[model samples]
Target: MRIHKRDKARRRMLALLLAGVLAVTGASVLTVAAFAGQRQPPAQPAATRMGTVACGDVGSLLDQVPAAAQPAVDRDLADLDVQVADAYRSLMAPGAGGGEQRVMDALVAKRTTTLRNLKASAGPDAGLPGDLTGLASCGIRRDLVVDASARDYAPDAQAGSSGSSGPSGPAALSKGSGNRGSGLGRGFVDIRTVSPNVAKPARTGSATGTFTSQCGRNENRHLNPDNVIVAPGVSNGAHHMHDYVGNLITDAFSANNRLARAGTTCSNGDQSAYYWPVLRLLNGVTEKDAKAPGGGQDSNVGRILQPADVQITYNSAAGNKVQPMTRFLRIITGDAKALTNGPANAHASWSCTGFENRQLADKYPICPNGSRVVRTLKFPDCWDGKNIDSANHRTHTAFSQANGSCPKNFRAIPQLVERVAYDVPTGVRFAVDSFPEQLHNPVTDHGDFINVMNRNLLDQMVSCINEGRRCG
Candidate 1:
């Protein structure tokens, strides 16, 4: 009977994890007693009212916890609410905008304090830390501040609407044969300006290759079930959905051995997987499920309308002597702190397909008669020459220099660039889906990759980079 009860508790915890609530594993052992006296609650009723609820007004958020554990979790969450609210008030002050750096620092400190207190408050048997920490990382809090500060915040509606002319890129050319030769707008973020256009480096013993676009064979490769973005052990914890292209099959459950056997869309047979959150066009038909798919989990704005094709590109760093990346290697580019991380931390660029010249900050590009919309993602090239993964998901790799050279003790690898083009027709505007707390800021857009190639396939990619041969 005791064993059966234990099994029941384990199943319950797993269900919660899948539902995007309980994120930690090894939690069932702690939940049995807490849940033994409590009756399982009924499924949540469909929401009758739909509107953005401030983090403080999330009354239903705590209803999912086991009755026995609710008091402790609620107490800590309430305390955290107060701290976050106070910090938001301070940062939103009219003149306080200039002190963003200071605001972020203060919020992080406060988050640490809240985490510590929550940990202390959660009794050993409560199993609350992972869930609490997952939903309230300093990064998450920063997004909240950004959203709270914005006036008339509406991500879903914004995502589906059409865009206005921005400062960067070409004067908006539509897609057609005649649109050729038009360049992107000046001062709008363009890799053609920053990255070298050389086919190969002049340095001795160096080579270069450019693999053209490969149509997306799969969008499931990097749908990380054990994403570090949320609590550890939480399947599909990222809350946001991602579109992956390259490795044929990958998910939170994928393993090196499995990926080694899997085929790739890259002509070189490189099975390295890359992905980022999918952008959604909010065309009235989609519901505004802020924390979509599952409430109190993703908290993102908008619904996803799949794109026709996702383009994948693999190539060497523009001007660097890049070494082959080791199998299973992983790293994070862009600012983990996101929008709060500042200008130097930004690595994302956006422009219209033909009008790639004009760039706008935080707004989607409006294309002209013959153009499409495009998002360009550039990965870091510098590797630590060791350690496949890091605790923070970064630190194992660094960015290359402006001249396309690796930093000391780091080797350059093929720079992964992805161009996702949308087929939205004229008069329709779309925005990248973001956390509701981000207030539709483009600065928070980022991508993630994991090298899952086996030894033989990985070796082949190395040869392509080193020998200056373009494959596929």
Candidate 2:
């Protein structure tokens, strides 16, 4: 706590050097303290975050690759993801300041090799540039991760209805409780402060039927870190734990044939896979997977919460009668790296059980005692009608237009709507598991699923939608 004359002189000089640099959460202050020879925590966090490693997203650059080349390309893509995660880990270590350039340089070399292999896998017909120069290099991308507010959770008394049990009297968020290390406090906002922002679009099509699937919650404890759609046969591809329902035997090694043979949690015998990153209550509790790959090892900690209710439904489109989703069609609804990748593909929607009309895309909602946190993901329903999947895992499926109509050349399919609600404890702060660099930002939340319905069930779904009847 004492300052010497020589130290004061050095601080004055350093302060001049960082004249314009500013941090709201004490990162810059710590850098000045480093001159005092005191051990300090790393500043590679969202508060005073250094940044994230980013390469040009290669998947979007691809038009289409040969069907035979998919497996190798998927593996190489998964490898690139791991490389960036490793680089972030290094950057988070103490005394990693001047080492940023070295770490990024090494990451670029690794990505270059992987991009080369990926291009070769695509073969001559895939139409990839020979050098892949711009796509191969990676650098630190400046991401804005400042906390919007540190205000306490004080719900308005009138915010709760007569029948509701939350936030009216003594039920309030615990004071001074947080998990700042895992990015919790800053990501949450009191739901009472938000206004209604949701509006239902008008529909005019004759096909008014809706099909609901009774897929049970993850009562089976089926969890893993693999992503079968994007990173098949690659372990730890997601770098986080996922709550899975539907398919029984899904993993990174699961092929279409293997998935087809697996049992399901769906009551109708649907063998499809539906999964998303698990949400966690950041209350400093040790979980079973604390030392596991997708848990603490990947910078995702705290107690995982099981959904109190999970609803999966499919609705008809406004354009025409919905067609059957091609068996084994793969779809990813949100961007897992949205924090660094930008909001173009980000689709995570957060709300409270009763305050669902005020959906939040970037901040987590602080629900009252009786209320629970909710995550709703609406999957794309327009299909290209040719491939079961695409090189980018997105080109084959697309969202409907604002009027709920499919785009030109795209066929209308039953839109999948998933709503999962979590009973987060009173006063507890929470966040969904995300990539190490993503820092559990709500924007990085996403979901993945595949269609493995049998022919009879597919026909039933189409018939129900066309007939304007609600059937599960």
Candidate 3:
């Protein structure tokens, strides 16, 4: 989602993968390789230099809560996130709290009371995670990996200047509204320096087909801060701006009927809602939402970079044929709270155009000339086949195993891979918008989708995949 490199050496990774046909889903099938033409950069030191407030992930614990209880539970959970973020800021304020521990202690005390209330909301049969009281405590993250090749912008240039892409040219590097303890820091790596770490799986599966959705980039500027899948009806649910490519009227308030009747950007009349956090260049320019809740006010400052290309492809699971995903199916890929929750659910894949083989989960990529930044988010392909959504927004679907087999009680479904590319000017730092406490780390990058495809169309997609034909 973020970086800049000062070295002007032009080393094209001819051995790296640019584009080819493959069953793109998860780490199992992905491969990273470096071309033998260039000298390798020094090994990167893998650790975060900055620290941020870390707390128990309350939302991830709930598997299934009553619809009636979800409102209160959701509100309480969202409040918990707010409280932790607030404490993080308090820790950063001039002459802040009793240091990090005291601030964490205070946050834990507050969270204890909230956890009690949340338990009350869920009741006995809600199936929430255990040890709510134990989850109240909070801490700090100091072990996140930092990009060794990270380069800072020219200090004298204004935050909003649209400078050149060369070594000495100044790209937009803003102060994030002077918001301390935020923005990108040592989060970018030179793509040419990374060696191949990905390997093709031992064996390919039975299904060998793909269905692509030709949804154009957000040409109409369909942007918002709502997460209809996870926090429906909650304004500013995401706490950051999102770019939409499918459904035109997907917002915090968009109901099922409204979404069905809304216009779409898809050429084939598919009404699926595809959205993800906006990638931002730190060029010091004021955006339309600079002072809004999800913008500068939320510490997501900078000019939002429109993706140069976005390819939404669905590949059949390797295990077996995929059944059609029901309308209204909701799937979320990646952890928006990964900075605090760790990498268990994180799906970040950042790299440059020609260096797609060298995917970096925690670092932004500095591309060579004519190259651009890229974000690859591959969704889980195994469906439980019962619920369209789950309490935690994840249990309804799951990722296929390394051999591309569905797990127990889970059936193969079309796995969605959202590959978005951005033309970030060379030598400029950029970042994915995130919760202020997350420090806009590239690891927090995520994607959201709602399947509103018509039944006939979905059936057609399934047929295309099962037939081993690449169709759109």
Question: TM-score for every candidate vs. truth?
Answer: 0.57, 0.81, 0.79
What would the TM-score be for candidate 3 when compared with the true structure? 0.79
- Point to the candidate with the largest TM-score: 2
Tens-digit per-residue lDDT, 75-114, candidate 2: 8888888888898788766667666656666776787789
> On residues 38-92, what C-alpha lDDT tens digit does candidate 3 reach at each position?
3222221212133455565667655457778877887888778778767766755
lDDT of 3: 0.68
lDDT of 2: 0.70
| Model 2 misplaced regions, further than 4 Å | 1-49, 124-128, 146-184, 317-319
- Name the weakest run of 10 consecutive residues (lDDT summed) in model 1: 27-36
Which pairs in model 3 have colliding backbones? 32-196, 32-357, 48-144, 159-284, 160-284, 160-285, 172-283
Ranking by lDDT: 2, 3, 1
How high is the CA lDDT of each candidate model? 0.46, 0.70, 0.68
Q: In model 3, state the lDDT of residue 171.
A: 16
Query: Residue 279 CA error for candidate 3 (Å)?
Result: 0.7
Better of 1 and 3 by lDDT: 3
